[model samples]
Target: MVLRKLFRRQAEPDVQIEKGLEKTRKGVFLEITRLFDRSEIDDELFEDLEMLLIQADVGWDVSQRLVKELQDRIAAERIVNPADAREVLRLEMIQLLELATRNRKVKILQRGVPFVILVTGVNGTGKTTSIAKLAQYHQGFGRTVMLAAGDTFRAAAIDQLKVWGERLDCPVIAHQQGADPGAVVFDAMVAAHNRNVDVLIVDTAGRLHTKHNLMAELHKLRKIMQKHVPEAPQEVILVIDATTGQNGLVQANEFSKSVEITDIMISKLDSTARGGIAFSVAKELGTPISYIGTGERATDMAEFRPDTYVDSLFFGEGEGF
Candidate 1:
């Protein structure tokens, strides 16, 4: 919810994330701004506030934690005017987000074996687009990128990744529909090594008929990559649909159980008002959010910056919540 609602002007991209989070910002801050009207800070002040946070998609545990944090700050600071406590609240929420990322930068390809990222998500989560944006993002840094259409479950997924591969001017190693996904990744790894590609992004199946099967397949894919480069598959990036609200947390948890999720990419943020799922993701999974989809273009994605995000959300003057 915060880092620097130190209430300053934000950069252009910050403004875009702020705009995309408008729905969530309004929902969460409106009630918070209303609470500021109270002259006294008491236990009753936070009554039902947990529910409010949950309604904003902040998740249950973090909501309770934020409320308790507010209680502690009020007593420690001898705060009377509820308005002065807003900054305290902001700091605590920022701490939650920061704790999730732990000040670590998103992993880009480094000098070594081909840096591999395995992307996974349920169907309709915009996994493919997130992969494309990720490739474009690395290409912006001048890295040689390649894509592997390991998503043989759906014919469309293969064609879509191929389209992105062509558009980004990167090589795409793929097998025909119904081919073994792990074999696809294995061949992609060989190609990446031969070509000295800096990054190899592998797209996996969106959904499998059984959870157990999906889990096994992911393990196979990981092993296949490691066969080529022991330390490869450096990051397992999970793309989630922001509009899925709290349910997205369940998806993250389920997938994490299947494969280690090192980072997150939230897609279609601009389309949802309840983008507070970002807070829940950090609190529940403790994974750094790599990017947020702000629009449809390749550049529509924004690398998440906790401080800039908070400043942008709470920036304007006297704007009624």
Candidate 2:
């Protein structure tokens, strides 16, 4: 009962969380509010709003659902003012985003075994760098971590991961270029088990989802893990580039078909990319987005929280919460 109370207390509203979400909210609101002004709502305004949502990476189907709901509410209530319409639309969008944010907690590592996490994504999505940042984050929490350079297809990938491991003072397992990724993972698992490390983050090759051989390779990695530890690879996180916008959704769809993507980590959100794609991906795929990379810093990544994000969306002027 005491521990439960402590957990409930920690669940209280967080102001810093709202501050972190401000980056995503500001980008989204800028695109959305541009459609409305002092002018009255009209057919042109509706069309513009629809187009804006699509361009912001909100999929057509989800955008239509939002527009339809807004139209219904406006028609029933005789709403006309652009400001009022914007607020109503904002509220509806917030509600839709809330659906994607449900159960966004990351699973804690169980005791007495290394929590294996297999990271994979297309090249240029920041998979290896994100893994390093994640290692730093977990290490800050006093967890012993080992990284595996399973992307032996590219020599540069292996070198980059090794650089990160060295900088962070963590062990990294790697093989020669063009080697089997599964074998690298196997070696890493052996080292992790022998060293009794708290976590093992395996970095896999990044290939386009359309590439059948690459997708098949990921399947083989999973099969290898099951052979050693049935419950290993506790989490398979797909690192997505926020700048890709709507195209990210297509990648998510294809990857999900090939492997069970337990969570999503959207990176490079500090740029001009409208971060609304995060909402669309979560809404469409029904996968919990556990974390978001705001900047290149190791501490830039943050846990996704719905209430904070909603606050940032509605109250744009203030410091989120």
lDDT of 2 at 70: 89
Cα lDDT tens digits, model 2, 1-321, are 445323322111234334444665566566566667757888887777777777667778888788888889999999989889987987887777777668565577876678888997878888987898788767767789999998887899999999988877789999999888889988888888889899899998886345898888888888887776678788899988888987878888888888888888887766533666766876888887777676665556766666555555556555322
Query: What is the alpha-carbon lDDT for the whole of candidate 1?
Result: 0.79
Residues 97-134 of candidate 1: C-alpha lDDT, one tens digit per residue:
78667835545555757999999888889888988888
Residue 192, model 1: lDDT of 91
How high is the lDDT of residue 60 in model 1?
83
Relative to the true structure, candidate 2 reaches a TM of 0.83
Q: How many residue pairs clash in each candidate?
A: 0, 0
| Reference-based lDDT, residue 283, model 2 | 81
- lDDT (C-alpha, whole model) for all candidates: 0.79, 0.76
- Model 1 regions lying over 4 Å from their true place: 1-13, 37-45, 103-108, 316-321
